[model samples]
Target chain A: MNDISTWDVVRNLLDGVLWTLGLSLTAFVLGGLTGLALLFARIASTAWLRKLAKAYIEVFQGTPLLMQLFIIFFGSSLIGLELSPWLAAALGLTLFTSAYLGEIWRGCVESVPKGQWEASASLALSHFEQMRYVILPQALKIAIAPTVGFSVQVVKGTAVTSIIGFVELTKTGSMLANATYQPFLVFGLVALGYFALCYPLSVFSRRLERSAHGTRAH
Target chain B: MTYAFDFASLLEYRDILLAGTLRTLALTAIGTFFGLALGVLGAASRAWQLAPWNRVFAVYVELIRNTPFLVQLFFIFFGLPSLGVSINEWQASILAMVINLGAYSTEIIRAGIEATPRGQIEAAESLAMTRRQIFLRVVLAPALRKVWPAICSQVVIVMLGSSVCSQIAAEELTFAANFIQSRNFRAFETYFVVTGMYFLLALAIRQLMLRAGDRLIGGRRT
Candidate 1:
């Protein structure tokens, strides 16, 4: 818990970045898949299913991620299930991202002009086929930019997992800082790691936005 | 595994939970009020492209937007004291919340400002309106009306994000719940009640914001 070499701290910090990356990527992919389903359900369904999906979005989006993580991690274990910290954090982030991403994609889907739907309907395709072949393809192309943009949110969100004791980058940074008595050096590098992971996605999202502008404006 | 349900314990902590909700609501209201003012100025600066200040505002917006609210909270609560301007946890948390919300609001409102039709500005000028008159009458008012929904949602986000202040021991709802659980060891019941409270409060605030925003721009709806 005393003074430690910069190298030791850096290595430990690197492990933190790995956990952050692991948590963010796991959440992003799983969240994306789940969100796509949610978006489809929201758009292509009866009134009840749409309301259910809306409720899901509102519940997840309305609540704080930290509280959600706490509920998943500790609350479940309180009942009968013994959930791991990583599992709980991942589940929380996945649910959070799904709500946001579902809404984003739903907007994009609905943003596809009604003319497109009418045009597709004239071709005698079912609603699902219209989405699969025509609407979704265009919507997904538009969705790529915002989806990549939200990955920044996903990356930043992994920092919250530290609160749940998942020992991700932020948690590790705090521990190493506490052990080394170097909060500034430790957190500065921690911020650097997050910035490094997220800045690229930010740049990518902007590029997607530019490309989107070049083609179709959303 | 079957466990008996206990609602009485949760009900007993209603006063504590109520206090936390009030604190959180106060934080959200004060934060949104000042944050909206800061946001308006920031958006105006960007719209005006006020030299170096605009560049500085841009960096502030992007930096805050790209990072985690938790890190920002830590930086303020823990990172600021090293520079010798010590603020308490509550003040620091509120400062950070306002700063973060200000940046996001600037972006949203700037988009609104930019969307104002160019011909209206020409019309205002033809009527001999000065720059100030034109901005208030022709620019800021209508722009905010149109952008109210986006701003409203981001404000709700600020409300939700304020829960992160609990980490710094801000005595907000979540912080209060954490205290109750640690003391009472009723983690599940405590959080269940707390979560329900948060959901209800958030829904209430969101509705209020929507109604307020709609009224502010109710004329525009027609």
Candidate 2:
């Protein structure tokens, strides 16, 4: 039997960082597109679409991500569908991210001055044409800083998927800690790995926020 | 085979659920009270241009903000014991939550402090107010008022995030659900009910925090 050394534990933990990044990327991409859909639904002319989108956002935002992962992973199995941890984590995070991003983007859209809408309407632009041509471009500019800011959240959120047996950074950290019997060292390294990924994003978000504010101040 | 949903079976665990909910509320209350207090102090030090403490707190906020709360919890709950500083799940949960909330609120409150008109502070100084007096009486309340809504939402986020405390067996709502599901093997039913409870709890906490904000800092001019 081979015993795991400190170096081996660190090496395996580094591997886990890759999965964390991969899952985060997957969730962000899928969640971003879905979230854009949700934003439109939230502000749609149809009253029911807005209501339905509101409820969807509330349910996802209100519950803990851990429970959402659990239900999605376990509940699917009860219905005779074999759901992988990867798929479940992706789906759970995508849904959760969609709700938050939807709300954030909706705020950006609504914050656009009323005159823009009125002017676009007077131009006889259809609702779709107005959103596509006039409103979304402006909203997208307002949304950029926040959307990037939210990506930090999406990165940290991937850690929760470890609980559902996904072999992300946190999960591997725990495993290496158990094998090496050095919880402090192993988890410390894992925290560093996460910090390395998230800190730059945090700094970038702040810069984007400053730039956004700078433009607005002018 | 059909899996019939039996929510009635969950009624038997109502006591456990209620106890867990109360524990969660207690943890949230304790964490928020101390966290906000500490955050104001941290923000004041930064606002006052205290050199090393300001630098110290800046690093602290960045470190806490960048890391995942679960890893933070594990480090405190699991890692600390190895160094001979032992604490129970409840203590660890509270400590982690408070520390996490403190870091977040520091940044939020500091933003408010930065927004304070410089003239206001100068006027207070011209009135012969001491630094501490000016900070506490003149700055803190208004800083809190400016950021009250943001802080309230963050508090609710912390409350919702507290469900992760169950990972350390802190006996919060999530823990209750796990305990019941293990016994009855009704994982779906258990999580479903608990999720609903959490949704309701999040709503209730938001309402409660907003009311507390209004009462505490609603009316007075800065």
| Native-to-model Cα distance after best TM-score fit, residue B135 in candidate 1, in Å | 2.2
Candidate 2 docks at the CAPRI level of high
lDDT of 1 at A195: 79
Report DockQ per prediction, comma-separated.
0.65, 0.81
Candidate 1 lDDT over B106-193, as tens digits, reads 9999988998999999999999999999998899888998888788788878888888889888989999889888877777778777
Report the TM-score of chain B alone for all candidates: 0.94, 0.94
Measured by TM-score, the strongest candidate is: 2
lDDT tens readout by residue for model 1, A87-156: 9989999999999999999999988899999999999999889988999998888899999999999999
Give stretches of model 2 more than 4 Å off: B220-222
lDDT at A184, model 1: 67
| Lowest lDDT block of 10, candidate 1 chain B | B213-222
lDDT for model 1: 0.86
